[model samples]
Structure formats: C-alpha cells, structure tokens
Target: MNEVAILCVDDETVILESLQEQISRHFGEQFMYEAAESAEEALEIIEELNQEGVKIVVIVSDWLMPGMRGDELLVKVHQQFGDITTIMLTGQADEKAIERAKREANLYCCIHKPWRKEELLKIITTALESV
Candidate 1:
C-alpha cells in the first residue's frame, strides 16, 4: 500500500523539527511524516508524493512565513487536492485569513503557536479519524 503522509510546513527549522518529532513519536510507522520550510517547497513535495501514489492525509502549516502565508497555501492545496485535511498552526494570523481558510480550504482546525502537545495531537487524531 502507498504510505499516507502528514506534511508540516513552517519557516522555522526548530518548529518543523519539533513537529516531526512529536508526530513520529505518537504515530510511529502508521503514517509518513514530511516537512517543508516554505509553501512553494511544500507544494512541490506534495506533487511529487502524489505522483508516487502516496496519499497526503493532512497538512499542518504555520500562518506567518517568508512568502505565501499558510492560509493561501492551504487554499491552493484545497483547490488541487480537496480531500486532504488542513490545520493552521500560527502565532500571528489575522481573523480574516483564518476565515478565508475555513471557507476556501476546508480547514480542519487552527491551533495557535506554543500549542499544547496534547491539543495538537488530539486535533490531528480527530482529523485522521474523519478521513
């Protein structure tokens, strides 16, 4: 079976590392974990993985980045791959951006920065369950 993926996008290397560690620890070998430092890189990774017959089950993205904010990335992802669930993990996203993600991206949820590990894990678990 093609392995399903959980992709996390964050400009900060530390944040990306931590997210990957947490997800790997909790999920073990159940899902493939992928990370990208920018929206453009993440999109490329998604396309490559899709071509390999991998299903991307979820994306957790940071709101503030160098270019193409999380909301915009998720919206674009939704337009191309509507079935993939999305979660915004942001420290500084405005209300308008969040609403746009909800409406256009079918955002699963938004978790703020300095997030509780349990909360983040729970939200991801819920999203995966629905999938």
Candidate 2:
C-alpha cells in the first residue's frame, strides 16, 4: 500500500512553511506532505492527486482562510471523499464553526497555533491508525 499523503492548507506563507517543516521534521519520510496557500488551491491539488491515485489520507487546514474557511473546506472534502481525515489548525475557531465541522465533517482533531511537534505527531499517528 502507498504511504499516507497529507495536505495542509493555510493562507499565510509563513504558517504554511512552518507546518511543512515541522511535520517533515517530525515524521521524516513516513508521510508525503503537501501545502497549499488557500482552500481553492488545495482543492485543485487534491483533485489532481486523487486522479493520480495518490490518496491523501489526511488534511490539516487553517480555519481563518480568505475564501472558504477550514470548516467549509473540510466539510466539502468529506462529502466527496469520505475516507480522508480532516483536521482543523487554527489559533481559535468560533463555536459555530466548530459545531458545523463536527456535524458535517469527520474532524480528526484541532491543533492550535504554535503547536508542539510531539502533539502533532501523536495526532497524525492516531489519525492514520484509525484508517
């Protein structure tokens, strides 16, 4: 079986870079990490990757995005692709947003900003194990 690929989306380039670097440092070559600057770009990349038969097992998205928020993106992704795990990464997500994601999306977990490497690894490992 192919290794689990992870897609992380954030509007801020700095945040995106940090996530990519931290996740890579933690997991090494165990996961295929891909980052997108926005939900639109992320959706496009997901489509392309899916077409290539490179299944993305997890998606970590920021809640406060420019266009579609992380909750919306995750809900949409879950609707089309049921097996892809969705995790929200945000400094703070409102109650309404969290409720929506919980109802419509299969949220693995929410990781706050300035996350610790160990916590992120544990979440990823657990999420993958559930698959």
Candidate 3:
C-alpha cells in the first residue's frame, strides 16, 4: 500500500520538530509525517509526493508564513486536492482568514498555537477516522 502522509508546514523549525515528534509518538508507523519550512516548499512537496503515488491525508500549517499564508495554502490545496484534510495552527491568524479557510478550503479545524498535545492529537485522530 502507498503510505499515507501528514504534512506540517511552519517557518519555525522548533514548532515543526515538535509537531513531528508528537505526531510520530502518537500515530507511530501507521502514517508518514513530513514537514516544510515554507508554504511554497510544502506545495512542492505535496506535488512531488502525489506524483510518486503517495497519498497525503492531512496537512497542518501555520497561518502567518513568510510567503503564502496558511489560509491561502489550504485553499490552494483544497482546489487541487479536494479530499485532503487541512488544519491551521497559528498564533496570529485573524478571524477573516479562519473563516475564509473554513469556507473555501474545507478546513477540518483551526488550532491555536501553543496547543495542547492531547487536543492536537485528538483533532488529528478524529480527522483521520472521518477520512
């Protein structure tokens, strides 16, 4: 079977590392976890992974990225890959952006930064189950 992937996008290396560690610890080897430092890089990774026949089930992204914001990235992802689930993890995302994502991106959830590990895991687990 092609491995399913969970991609995390954040400019902060520490946040991405923490997310990868926590996700891997909870989900183990059932799915592959990937991270990107920028929205552009994440999009490239997604395209490459799709071309290689890997299924990306979920994306966790930061809202205030340097280039493309999280909502914009999620909207793009939804446009290209409608079935993939998206979660926004951000400290600075405005209400407008969140609402836009929810409407346009079919965003699964929006998590605030400094999120509890349990809450994050629960959201991902629930999303995966639904998927």
Candidate 4:
C-alpha cells in the first residue's frame, strides 16, 4: 500500500503541536503526520513527500500566517495536486477568503479556530473515505 500523509500548518508552534497530538491520538499510525510553521515550509514538505511517493491526502492550515495565507496555500496545492484535499482551520479568515478557497481550491471544508476535536476527526475521516 502507498504511504499516506496528513499535513497541518500553523504559524503558532503550540497550535501545531496540539493539532499533531490530537490527530496522532485519534488516527494512531494510520497516517504520517507533518507540521509546518509556514506556508512556504509546508509547500517544501509537500514536494519532498511527493518525490518520495508518500501521498498527502489532507492539509489543514491556518489563514493568518506571515507570508502566504491558508487560502492561497490551498489554492496553490490544489493547482499542483488536485487530488489532495485541503481544509482551512483558522480564527481570523474572512468570509471572502473562505469562499475563495472553496471556489478555487475545491477545499474540502472550513473549520473555525478552537475547533471541536470530534468534529475535526469526523471531517478528516470523511475526507479519507472519499480518497
């Protein structure tokens, strides 16, 4: 079977750690979990994983990063890897950004910050089922 990965991107280190912990606890070793501090770093990780034949099935990202915002990042990822599902998990993203991600990136879903763990896990589970 091909290796699978789930990437979580956030500018905050604490948020990144929390997300990774929750996902790992819920899914166990079912996926290779990756965390990036910025959109640029996330893109690099995606490229490296793709080259290694690890399929990145999902990306959960924050919107208010230093450089590329989550919507922009998702759009780029969608353009390059259309099969990968993108999700926005952010506190400060405006409605326009969410809509743009949905329209341009074919984003899987948007979850506001301080998300419920169960809800996140459910969304991810559904996305993986579709993949």
Q: What TM-score, computed on C-alpha atoms, does each candidate reach? A: 0.98, 0.93, 0.98, 0.97
Writing each residue's lDDT as its tens digit, candidate 3 over 19-106 gives: 9999989998888889999999999999999998899999999999998999999999999999999999999999999999999999
* Better candidate by TM-score, 1 or 2: 1
Q: Write the per-residue lDDT of candidate 2 for residues 1-131, one digit (tens) a residue.
A: 35468998999999889888988887788778889999999999999888878889989899999989999999999999999989899897997988798889978898888788788879988988899
Backbone N/Cα/C clashes per model:
0, 0, 0, 0
Candidate 4: misplaced stretches above 4 Å? Answer: none
**What is the alpha-carbon RMSD of candidate 2 to the true structure?**
1.6
Judged by lDDT against the true structure, how good is candidate 1? 0.96
Distance from true location, Cα of 4 in model 3, Å: 0.5
For model 1, how does the per-residue alpha-carbon lDDT over 39-110 read when each residue is reduced to its tens digit? 999999999999999999999999999989999999999999999999999999999999999999999999
User: In model 2, what is the error at residue 67, expressed in angstroms?
Assistant: 0.8
lDDT of each: 0.96, 0.89, 0.96, 0.95
For residue 94, give model 1's deviation from the true position in Å. Answer: 0.3
The reply for model 2, stretches above 4 Å from the true place, is 1-3
Measured by TM-score, how close is model 2 to the native structure?
Answer: 0.93
lDDT of 3 at 26: 99
Let me know the TM-score candidate 1 reaches against the reference structure.
0.98
